[model samples]
Target: MSTSKLFDSYKLGPITLSNRTVMAPLTRNRAVAGFVPNPLSVEYYAQRASAGLLITEASQISQQGQGYQDTPGIYTQEQVAGWKKVTDAVHAKGGHIFIQLWHVGRISHSSLQPNGGKPVAPSAIAAKGKTYVNNGFADVSEPRALELSEIPGLIEDYRVAAKNAIAAGFDGVEIHAANGYLLEQFARDSTNKRTDEYGGSIENRARLILEVTKAVVKEIGAERTGIRISPVTPANDCGPDSDPKKLFDYIVDGLSAEKLVYLHVVEGATGGPRDVAPFDYAELRKRFKGTYIGNNGYDLALANKALAADEADLIAFGKPFIANPDLVARLKAGAELNKPDQATFYGGGVKGYTDYPTLAEVKQAAE
Candidate 1:
């Protein structure tokens, strides 16, 4: 029964959120066989159904799009069936859910790729990072540059994934253009050395993501399509852009033109400092005319402050939601949160995934 704007309902595109808190997409890397969502995921997400919106862990659009081991995918009927249960469980509790569509590009190892082939990226240059594969972290395989002919097929993959998400009963889908993934790889010049139509100039570099966004919007409606972007994050060896402000401003402008439902922006580094670089986030906010979701390192105070200042329409909390299934209730009551176990974060069973006790449970135990 808090009076803060953080507890208020929000109208996002076509749907109304119960509160302004969003559970950000967190990769647990716990998919079962055929890259389907782990059966436990339904319970895991249902436990967190009190959030205003729950964005599922980044699900690969196709086998070629996978990077980390054991993460879920959305391309096949089996995978769609797995997610339907998750969506159904979330909806039964009066919650809204969106699935994040992902393509990891060069952030993958050959073992995770189709036929043990090389991962694909905007260019052939290898990212100086590692991906979890075969239950261990290994250096990302050197990627082959995507042929221009392959671009259409890639966009098609996103479109089909969006369609699959809807079929799986997701309220919407968030294109994962953030965190140096496939789309980000194309958008950032540091990783995109292609001299083709998709490289060099800012517009050229921005083409692939824009096109993918357009395709997803076309497949689904714009009101059902949102996107996530991390402008300056050096995650997965995506080097700093020459002019991040200019680049993201142009990108945001294009996304605004598409009239996306919301623009989820990761402020500063992915999981690191907020002031990792100085880029005016307000500019992107001004450019995009839809709901704005602010993410990364946000606590209750910051969320309240951002909403009060009208900096964001919603606040997406990552790790907090992991250990606190009842995050909104805990925040409303100002209760202590359960700390997440880092040891079992990546790939695991239900211990770290769904066993976190809620505040009410803790209170009952104490009593």
Candidate 2:
């Protein structure tokens, strides 16, 4: 396949991207004692600044929003200052970045939660996965259903986090609502069984996400707000939605009213087969007029095909970015890519994180 299409420029919100490729958010538990993006993360991101856009790993909006160990948060002043260095470094290298605001909901342990309170979700069910905490993997604990009174505060958390993101010098913010996290817990019918306004029907199940989006948009202008959603992703122990196409179509149509900069959708299961469900990508793409990012299992050929057919405005690569900091240039030059070392993916030093040699560096070594 010709690599011309992936190299084409496109407009995203107020900034003009050099290309349509995006570095998908990756969860590397590399943070300071205060859960701030450290100097290592700064270098890690700056190295891959050539991508059209870089999304930071899912950052907890508040302490209560965290689900894993050492993941950064956006609420504190120290965290903002730490992230500022990262954004500044990316900007210095002529790259744009957006912080992904996140909340893991029930997929958390008591040690990760504040005041030793049980993790909060739309319902009090335990997910079927273990979260790596401190230095070991622990089973996810059963959660406490969120109180009605706490809903307002939850929205406020996103509002404050959005403001903090702009303060940290990010060009924009992407609301993390996918992959069976907090927002997805409320979005999917199987996870959410509440009878209140925030549960039950699709509209009710979608209320929390819409409210969070509205709050974030209010804090940072609509043009700078983007959201991610997975219609049928069973990741993080999520169950299948009875009617994925109808459910996600309603979600896409509802999100359009917010005038978000983009809607990022994971076409199928995360990190699994691309055809895990029967939903139509074109249908979901048509529901939203704004830019659509198609993520989950994409290579150079698929990325070009999607853009050439107008199926997606952008493509996000996760594992590939881990070892290929010069992915964009490599694709353009048709060069070989280095394999990623998964053992060093989380809570590690510069080895697999930022030590991956560029194509030029590799060729020079060969000579």
Candidate 3:
């Protein structure tokens, strides 16, 4: 009978979360044919239903949105059907889930693009990295700057994906504007070199994300729409924003105007050091008037401290959720967490996906 704010119920928009702990989205690259969720995904997510909320791995909103091999998509009926099972399973265990809508933009290879075309981006710059495609890693293809005329269609894609998510049984949808992905590429100056309306100023760079957020919010009420943003994360060769504080403050202000249900912020570098930059996370927290989910390298002690200080309304755990399906129980009891097998992290079947045993199982095994 442990009691902590982290384990308390929370009301997020229209749905109520069992606890404040969220399972952050982690790409497993295990989608089957047609970029549909693998059958095992149903089991994988269902096992971690104890978390207050679960955000599934990034699923592309369109074929052109994909940047990796075997990632799931939500632009088709089959894909929606695949996800229906996943959502049903989570709900069956009295849990809530949200699907992250993604568009990789330039962080993609030609093979992963439709008709072997170049990936699209805010600028025609090639990211200094590789993307998983054709069953292996390859230099990302140089991208073509998205035409202004194409902007409307991209925004529409997000709206439709949000609609499909609700149809697929998701409690809500998270707009993947974080990482170095499509939306982030448009926001960061290092990657976006366009002089068009979508580039040049912090407000301009933040336009696409804001428009997409509004579109999603319109399609599915503000409470059902949340957005993720990483202000200073240098992931996906986004380099550094010339003024992260100014840029993200503007972004958060717009997101707040949209009246989104939550704002999931990656505090520092994604999966890296939390003190990688000097930006003030509290600034963004103050700007946004919604549930602020603090992510990146959060252990139990840090989570407690952040919650106690009111730095974040909820805390998101990434790797910890991968190895500990019963993460809520483990954290409550101050029990040791299972170490995730790095080898089976990506493109795996079942060994590391759903095989992690809970503390109860471990105790039973010893007995």
Worst 10 residues of 2 by lDDT: 1-10
155-270 per-residue lDDT for model 1 (tens digits): 99999999999999999999999999889999988899989899999999999999999999999999999999999998999998888999999999999999999999999999
Best by lDDT: 1
Over the full model, what C-alpha lDDT does candidate 1 score relative to the true structure?
A: 0.94
Per-residue lDDT of candidate 3, residues 66-172 (tens digit): 99999999999999999999999999999999999999999998888889999999999988998887777889999999999999999999999999999999999
Off by over 4 Å in 3: none
Superposition TM-score, candidate 2 onto the true structure: 0.98
TM-score of each: 0.99, 0.98, 0.99
Q: How many backbone clashes does candidate 1 have?
A: 0
What is the full ranking by TM-score, best candidate first? 1, 3, 2
State how far residue 325 of model 3 sits from its true place (Å): 0.9
Error of 2 at 86 (Å): 0.3
lDDT (Cα, tens digit) per residue for candidate 2, span 1-367: 3456788888998999989899999999988889989789889999999999999999999999999998999999999999999999999999999999999999999998898889999999899999999799999988999998999999999999999999999999999999999998988889999999998888888889989998999889989999998888889998987777777888888789888999988888988888997779899888898899999999988898898899999999999999999999988887777889999988878888989999989889999
